[model samples]
Target: MSSADDPKTARQPQPPSHAMVGTWRLVSYDVEVASTGERFPAMGERPTGYTIFSGEGRVWFMLTGDGRQPGDSDRDRAQLLETLIAYSGRYRIEGDVWVTAVDVAWNPAWVGTEQRRQFALDGDRLQVRTPWRVMPNWADKGETRSIITFERAVEG
Candidate 1:
């Protein structure tokens, strides 16, 4: 039989919504000043985090290791950051929207922060959209633009 006559290649399924539910590592992310679109000079090409999605209506995402936490004295920010990762919360999907109720965060300051993350996943590309700066801590120095994009993490 010819290659086209084989059944393997012909069995590939089209895009499916539930295909996105799984553990996905950070592929790449774009960070800019949320309100001004100002990009960080040092944020050249490094993204930090892992996201867990469950088709049964659950999500756990953690983003960390930016290397920009303030000093401990004037700002206890560094200590706080040193102790915990970005944020992880419970999430659910409705149609094409992914909403999160921040159940746990590194900093207790953000324990109650609720967020809405819009997502679109096709093949290996996964994108999440938000409208808030990454307030690293409760006493964020200021607002900083942040968005996270990821691709499928290969696993055996």
Candidate 2:
């Protein structure tokens, strides 16, 4: 049987009111420090990623830093991992926030956690911001929040 015909792989119809249900291409990803009000790109000047929200209430996200290079040593591999964030699971929308009950994640700690993102849609652009918290990737930066933007992908 085809994957789309399977109950587990089939996507349920999304409600017309669910505006965020679609595929989006990453535009920019930045991190902001709560204390100093400093903001910088999370990956680099031109990070890349994609996020897909299905009518079946599933969401998948994979983002990578700009200019990622292959590593030759353990340290290099670790750095590569640090520059990536990926997760997938069921999600639900609440007001302007979307929460995902992550079933799998690049970081094991996020596997069972609910990740919440506050988002705003403007035309074909969607901007998302995470809550301020101490991030493992940039703990030394203190409480930081991710500010990401995505453009709705056009299906030609």
Candidate 3:
């Protein structure tokens, strides 16, 4: 069959929303400073996380920084919290963006917020970017955005 006639090649014109309904392994989570165009991994060079989207439109994700250790004190516990990002909620896709109406989050401030993520899917890879905002984790850096990349997790 010709390439144009192949099911995979002619399946759809727009980004498939269903393509996101699965577990994804985090590849990198970086922060880009708005003013200088400087980008760096906000969670260290080897962070770990998982983002899962249910077929029923529920989404949940938890990302933690590299080399996290059990907190031994109040200060240590606070520091641990600084390196985590987690939330869950119902979600909807609008074109290339997915907005989650967050009902729960690591930060109470995010509990009732609508988290909008601009995304692009290429084969098994997904890249997501957040709108520029001052994040409590790195508020010292001023306005910044998070750039995250994930790969579809293979099911056993």
Candidate 4:
């Protein structure tokens, strides 16, 4: 069976350490256009993603649009690239903010950078928000803020 079909392989929740140390399955990912206040999905409405945090300060994150199939051409490959995001690094949680000191990222520009996101935990669900930043491929249009939600992965 495909990995997507198995919850165990899709994401497994790590033992809790603080509030952020756990595997999380993406539930929703949206970005709000700063100027217009219009929210749109960052990777379509049904994006698939996972974030895993270890008690030892390590973290891994990845997200991609659903329904992506193997690409056979350059355009297809580019499309795939445009639909995905991945990064990994050490992380620290301070108060209500979590910061990731990126060691590696799909985008070279993110390497060596620190990314901060405000987060809150409500029962088994997690919500995170990014600060407003220039929109990719549409910087001139306006800034955008990413808002994502996740739920702790349940082991079968």
lDDT of each: 0.63, 0.92, 0.92, 0.87
Deviation of model 4 at 96, angstroms: 1.3
lDDT by residue for model 4 over 1-156, one digit each (tens)?
887789896675443379777899999999888888888787887999999988878889999986789999999988898888899988888788889999999898999999999999999999999988896755765888889999999968
Q: Between prediction 1 and prediction 2, which has the larger TM-score?
A: 2
State in Å the error of residue 141, model 2.
2.9
In Å, residue 91's CA in model 4 sits off its true spot by: 0.2
What's model 1's TM-score? 0.61
Per-residue alpha-carbon lDDT of candidate 1 for residues 1-156, written as tens digits (9 for 90 to 100)? 886787996674332257667888876555556556665422335646788776655667776555546565855765545533466666656687776677786667767777776778878878776655555532243565445677888889
> Of 2 and 3, which scores higher on TM-score?
2
Pairs in clash, predicted candidate 2: none
Q: What is the Å distance of residue 75 in model 4 from its true position?
A: 2.6
Estimate the TM-score of every prediction: 0.61, 0.86, 0.85, 0.84
> lDDT for model 1, on a 0 to 1 scale?
0.63
CA RMSD of all predictions: 10.3, 4.8, 8.3, 10.2
Maximum-TM-score candidate: 2
Q: Which portions of model 2 miss their true places by more than 4 Å?
A: 1-17
Instruction: Rank the models by TM-score, top first.
Output: 2, 3, 4, 1
